[model samples]
Target: MKHLLTIFKYALLLALSGVLMWYAVRGQDLSTIGHYIRSANYFWLGITMFLSVLGYFSRAYRWKMQLTASHQTVSYWNVYHAMMVGYLANIVLPRMGEVIRCSVLRRTSGVPVEVSLGTVITERVIDVLVLALLLGVVLMLEFNKFWAFIESLFVDKYDSLAANRDVLLSVAGIAVLLAFVFGYLLLRNLDKLRENALFVKVIAFVKGLLAGVFSIRKMENKSLFLFHTGFTWLVYYLMDYLAFMCFPETYSLDMKAGLAVLTFGAFGMAAPVSGGIGVFHVLVQSTLLVYGISKEAGIAYALVVHGAQTMLVVLMGGISFIVSAIHSGKPAAQKQMSVSR
Candidate 1:
């Protein structure tokens, strides 16, 4: 049943990605995209791929610090291996990468799978919050330019709501009244609620997660963690900004434009598609379009950026997996041989 569910989820995400890819390319001239890609500056692209590797290393180190804070002493190389394997898994399996990451760490370092997963979950939450904060900054900087674009998204929804305002109001009134009644009842029966087996189990699980989420507060080297986090984002922006210089058509775009693209592209990557394949293209192209770039140019840019990053992950991840297997397999084999003797 679990395997079937996983397969179904992947199929759904793959279908959604295909639809988005079609929407992005439906009207574009493929020849022009190819031309732009062929003419791209390999110099900048080389640098972009270099930065991509550094980003992975930085992230691995940051994760190590998080694990250390929880008293799980793992080697730097193991963490790096786990991180690479996770990226490789993501290219093939979308969000299953996090589970793969925890599994790798557990096998390599003897850390409990649940504890490793807790740290990973904490890292993901932190990353999302940081991305949100960065998005807010970008919006503030470009709010005036995007006001109409943003307003258009909501104007239709506002009109629909206004048309049915009376009915919505009645629903809201009933929801608030029911909330009050439930809240009162829950408070009155707090002791009974605590005694419920399912509730008790859920509470215990939540507390463990909360402890992991708050682990940063107890870290000995909080400053180092902060530095790594900030540095990772900085490298991320540089990765995006450098890709702009890869083609003459996009070279004219400034840092602010890169920031906007980075913000939206991050959202695309965060989507449930495998490695942000189609959604990243659409969101990056859309952001470029807002800056008056031609659709062909945007597609070319997206192809180079996403392709190079993906290649880097695949290359490093392949090497890491092989090396980890050799390093991990030898000891277990020796132990088994000794036991047989």
Candidate 2:
């Protein structure tokens, strides 16, 4: 039953991704999008790929720092390999990358899985805080523009809701019914769920995770952590900004425009889909259209930029997985040689 549920979950996500991809491609000129893709400047795309690696390297370095604060003596190379493997896993299984990454660390460095997971949680918290700050700065600079954009997205539906008392009451009733049903189900299943083996493992993992998260207070060189955190985001923005140079259609766009795109694109990538495949294109294209870019151009840009980065993740992650496996085997190999001698 657990395996069935996992399969169902992946199927549902894939279905949603397909629906979103269809929406993204709807009403766009395929030929024009294709032409733009074919004619795009490879030079800029090369630079974009380079920036993506730099961003990954920075993240791995930051992870090493966090782990060091926790008093783990893992090498930077091992951490980086684990991080890359995680990224590669994400291309297929959404958030499963983190577990895969922590598993690598546990196998290679003898770190507890739960402890590594805790550090991952800490890193994500820091990332969310940074992303929130950047989003706020972008909104402050373009308040009216974004306000108008948001109003365009939802104002008509809200106005209609205000005029329709019966529709509103029905929706509220459904929501209440759902809450009641969910609460009842939870109460009924609580004991059995707690006794499940998976549940036991999760509780143990959470305990270790908390210890890792608290290690942030013990970190050395807080300044270096701050610098890497800032630099990682900066590199991310540069990847988006340089991708704009690949097409003449977006040549007139400035850094601020790229920031807006990056901000929305970030939300799309955060969705639970493999590599944000379809959702990223839709959100990014919608965002570009808001900035007066043509739909075809938006499609082209989204395909090129997001697709290239996804490819990079797959390629580098595969290589890193191999490297990590080889590196992790060295200790056993050395011990075997000594025994033979």
Candidate 1 residue runs with Cα over 4 Å from true position:
152-208, 327-341
List the lowest-lDDT window of 10 residues for candidate 1: 326-335
Q: Give the lDDT of residue 65 in candidate 2.
A: 86
Q: Write the residue-wise lDDT of candidate 1 on 1-341 in tens digits.
A: 99999899899989988899888888889999899999999899899788778878889998888888777778999989988998899988998898897777767776656667778888988889999998898889988766676576689999999999999999999999999999999899989989999989777767655655677877899888888888888888988998999889889989998898888899999888999989999989988888889999998899899998888889999998886776664444665799999
Q: Which model scores highest in lDDT?
A: 2
lDDT of each: 0.85, 0.87
TM-score of 2: 0.84
For candidate 1, give the lDDT.
0.85
The TM-scores, one per candidate, come to 0.84, 0.84
Please provide, for model 2 over 22-101, each residue's C-alpha lDDT reduced to its tens digit, 9 standing for 90 to 100.
88888878999899999999899999899889889999999998888877878898999999999999888989999999
Ten residues in sequence with the least summed lDDT for candidate 2: 326-335
